[model samples]
Target chain A: MQQNDYTYAVARIRFKETKLLSDADLDALLSAKDTDAVMRLLHDKGWGDGTSHTSDELFSMEEEKLWSFVSECIDDLSVLDFLRVPNDYHNLKVAIKCITRDIEPNGLFLSDSVSDAEAVYEAIKNRDYNALPEYLRDAAKEAMTTLLQTSDGQLCDIIVDKACMEHVYRLGKESENDIIRLYCELFVASADIKIAVRCAKTKKKIGFIRRAMASCDSLDIDKLSSAAAEGYDAILSYLASTDYRSAIDAINTSMSAFEKWCDDDMTAVLKPQKWEPFGIGPIVAYIIARQNEIKAVRMILAGKVSDISENTIKERLRSMYV
Target chain B: MSEILNNSGLFLALLGAAFATFMAGIGSAIGVGKAGVAAAGVLSEQPDLFGKVLIFQLLPATQGIYGLLVGFLILSNVGLLGGVEEVSLLKGSLYFAASLPIAFAGFYSAIHQSKCSVAGIGTVVKKPDQMGKALILPAMVETYAILALLISILAVNGINGIQV
Candidate 1:
């Protein structure tokens, strides 16, 4: 498709981009006295309204606003299915677990998912696999069955997570847009690396490790699984020879640090798209930036409310796209 | 046929006028349409930028007017806009040639200029303070279009003085 097709959409995205949080803004939030203080700061910056609200409420509001804005800008949002597909899988996991546990799935399911979380929950609740979207239908059945049979929540998560990663990877490969493909590549690959690191730490065998990790182009699943079997260091050594070599130090520090590096590096890599006037790239970048901004603010609020150290909070903050 | 060739001068001159009007008009339409979409996007969010984006959207429009102006010049020179007069084959050919610079330059320049205008609109969206700079970039595209207009005008007027 012609890149200019998104000219109008991208132009609106450009204006929307100005509302995203910058590094300096994040720093200011870092200095805020407490969670309420941070929310006040965000309110002042046009994050939420001036009305009294909790951070979670404000975060949900902002996510809704983002989806509304993006929906207004583009005609077809299916191009973003790769981004939302993970939410579908997460909701599926929540539903299966909640149903099996005979508990309410309140406040746990994500908003703005492809399929309605409540609908997904109901479908799973009634054991009507046909009601779910085709992409989630098979995975939902398998995960629910696995949880019922094995009574292993982790195994259920494994089944659902694996399906999620494979679906994201397949979508990325099928996409014609470079930004979508690249985002999916890093997303699945990073998940694989994290799984490898976790498996290596937990001393899980190669079979379970392979079962957990999805195949992506950037990471060699076989080599990574084999290296993961050895230990965390071996996994690190294996990554050092791959594209993720630069993240070795962050991995050495901690998985949380590695997660931060992944987010920060992706923003840094996609930052140039902010200046682009036309294409799906800028729109995707804006979405990523907004989501990251929300994540950073949530972390700050969580840390502040719990009285976590400032330096520790700063360590976890993802880089701003601005 | 010899009959058509003998009367081809008037036909050719008319064709030249049509070229200037339609070719550049098409380009301007495309340029203005593209810029207008971007401008609308900005206005939907920040309606205060209407004046600033309006200027950017109108920048590509000048080429269409220039095209119309050249078309009029060609029509008047060949007497189509006034009294019917016989124009030699050579003079008709010269008029056709003169229309080319604007016809093509206006066509391509409007498109390229609109690209610059679209980028400028994006810049203005982020930094409304840089409106002056943003306007200047696309206006530079006008220089070439003006140059083409200059040549076409001078050439058409000069062709009027020829005895052929």
Candidate 2:
């Protein structure tokens, strides 16, 4: 489709962006006395549906509201498969484990996945791979078989996660939109980096690390796998040669800090789209930004519930898109 | 051949007027429709901003009026409305040539201006207080359309005075 086709959607997203919590807003939420105060503050900001809700209820409602608003703006929700694919894979993981371990999958599935989680579970339960989406058919069958035959849940997870990354990367490559392509590249590359770092810390063999990491143009899976097998210092040295050199500090600080850096990096990349007036870029950026905002709020609420220090929560907060 | 030549000039002159009005009108329709979609989107979120967005939607509509004005001028000049019913082939062709500037310029400028207006509407959606700045960007596109209008008007008047 032409870029002009998204003009109306982009305009609405522009207005919606104004409602996103700024850094100052995050500070206020962070400094709030307790969970109740945080909930009250969010309610004042038009969160939830003008009803009393617990923190989880409020966050879930807000997430649903974001998707509904997006659905209202966009005629075809498949254009957002990049965002929904992860949830689909997550559900797949949950379903596989639940089926293997003989447990109910209640409350484990995410809402708004590209495919229905229960449907996925049923298809898996019936051992009918064809019922699933074509992109997911092979991965589902392989992961399920690997779990059943080997009784290795970790191996099953690696298979599913790699498939998810590959599918996401292929979708990105096929997309004509630049922003989607960039997002997918970053998503896979970041995931690979995280996998490599974890494997390095755990002292995994090169072959195992190679099996888990997905390949993308931005990062070489072979070099990354080798670096991961070598150690943390080698991984850092390898990252310093790539576009992700700036992420070294976060990687050095803590795993959580690195996670925050990855999100903030995405925010920084999407920040420019705020000024963009026409195209899918701004709309995609807004969706990601809203997701980021919700994540930040969830973190703050979780921290408050646990009585974590304000400074620590502040440290983990991501840069807002607005 | 001579009969065809004698008739062809009036046909061409009328064709020119039609081109000017039709092309520009199509452009304006597209431009205004695009801006209106954006306006509707904004209004859906904040209905109070209707007055501001309405102005942005109307900005692209002026190109159609300019096209109509030029078409009317061409019709009157060619005696198609009310005047001596005969004219030399040279004068008819001259009138046809005169309409070309607006015909092409109006068609392009309106569409480009609407893009600017749509972007401007997005600006207004975010920062209502910055309407003045937002409006100016699209209005700048008007300068080119007006320039084309001036050239077509001057050319039509000059053609009328020519004694060929």
Candidate 3:
């Protein structure tokens, strides 16, 4: 469809954006004395469906509400394949692990995947790889076979994770929309960087790092893999020459800090969509923003429950879109 | 050949009238439809903003009215509505030339104005108080259509004074 076709959806997104939690709202949540106080503030802000609920219940309900609202706004939800592909791959991973271990995969699947997790589990259990989507069929069969032969779960995970990243990058590249393209690029690059960092810290071999890291436009996978084989400083030095030079600090800080940087960088990239009045950019940004909000809320609730320091939780909180 | 030339003037003049009305009307329809879609989207979320969005939706509609006014003046001046049974070839050609400004300008201006209106609707959806500022951006696009209307009306009225 033409960009103008999203005129209605963009306008609605603009109005909905006003209701998104702002930085001030995050601060207010941060200042709350406990999770109960945070929940009270959330209830006042109309976060949940208005029924008395626990933090997890409220978070889950809010996530469901976001998807439902998106479904209402758009006719073809396939435009959101970039966002949904991860969940589908996650479900595939869960299904393969559960079926191999002979364990029931209850409550291990995400509800918002493009494919039903339970169906995927069933298909994997029956060894009917054809039942999976074409993009996932080969990956599922390969991962299951590798797990059955070698009994190595990490290898299976790496195979599926690489496939998922490759699929997301392909989908983004095929999309005519700039936002989706940027999102896919960032998603793959970030994942690749995360893998490089983890592998570097674990002193993994070059072959394993190369196999695990997905190719993306921004980062050089070969260089990143070699850096991972070298050491953490080499990875930092290599990142210094790329567009992600600023992220080196976050990497040096802690894994959580680096993860926070990824989320913040995405928010920074998508912040301009607020003023954009046309196309799917605003809608995509809105969905990402809501997800970020939910993530921040979950972190806060977890922190409050565990009695973590306010300053620590505050550092980890993501910046809101509104 | 002479007969064809004589009739060609009237044909051209009538074609000009049709172009003025049809092209501009299509542009306005498109413009209004685009803005209406955005307005409906906003109303679905916040129905209270209907009054503001309605004005935005109507902004591109004026180009159609301008085109119609110019078309009506040409038809009357050429005696298509009544009075004179025929026009000289020179006067007919002049009328056709007179219709060109609104015919082309109104056709493009209204379509571009609708784009502005749609963006304005987005602004109003987010910041209701910014309606005044938002309305001004789309209203700026109307200036060209008004200029075209002015030139077409003056040229049509002036054509009647020629001795040809």
CA lDDT of each prediction against the hidden true structure: 0.90, 0.89, 0.90
Q: How far off is each candidate at the interface, as Cα RMSD in Å? A: 0.5, 0.8, 0.7
What's the number of clashes in each of the models?
0, 0, 0
If both were scored by DockQ, which would come out higher, candidate 2 or candidate 3?
3
In CAPRI terms, model 3 is classed as high
Docking class of 1: high
Fnat by candidate, in order: 0.74, 0.74, 0.84
Can you give the TM-score per candidate against the true fold?
Answer: 0.96, 0.98, 0.97
- Least lDDT summed over 10 consecutive residues: which range in candidate 2 chain A? A1-10
Ranking by lDDT: 1, 3, 2
List pairs with backbone clashes in candidate 1: none
Report the lDDT of model 1 for residue B117.
Answer: 95
TM-score of chain B of each: 0.97, 0.95, 0.95
Per-residue lDDT of A271-299 in model 3, one digit per residue for the tens?
A: 99998878888999999999999999999
Candidate 3 per-residue C-alpha lDDT over B88-110 given as tens digits, one digit per residue, 9 for 90 to 100: 78878888888889988898998
Give the per-residue lDDT digits (tens) of candidate 2, residues A1-322.
2544788788788789889999999999998999989988998999998888787888789889999999999989888898999999999999999998999998898998999899999998888999998878998999999999999998999999999999999999999988899999999999999999999999999999999999999998899999999999999999999999999999999888888888888888888898887878898899999999999999999999999999988888899888
**What's model 1's lDDT at B7?**
73
Stretches off by above 4 angstroms in model 3 are A1-4
| Ranked candidates (TM-score, high to low) | 2, 3, 1
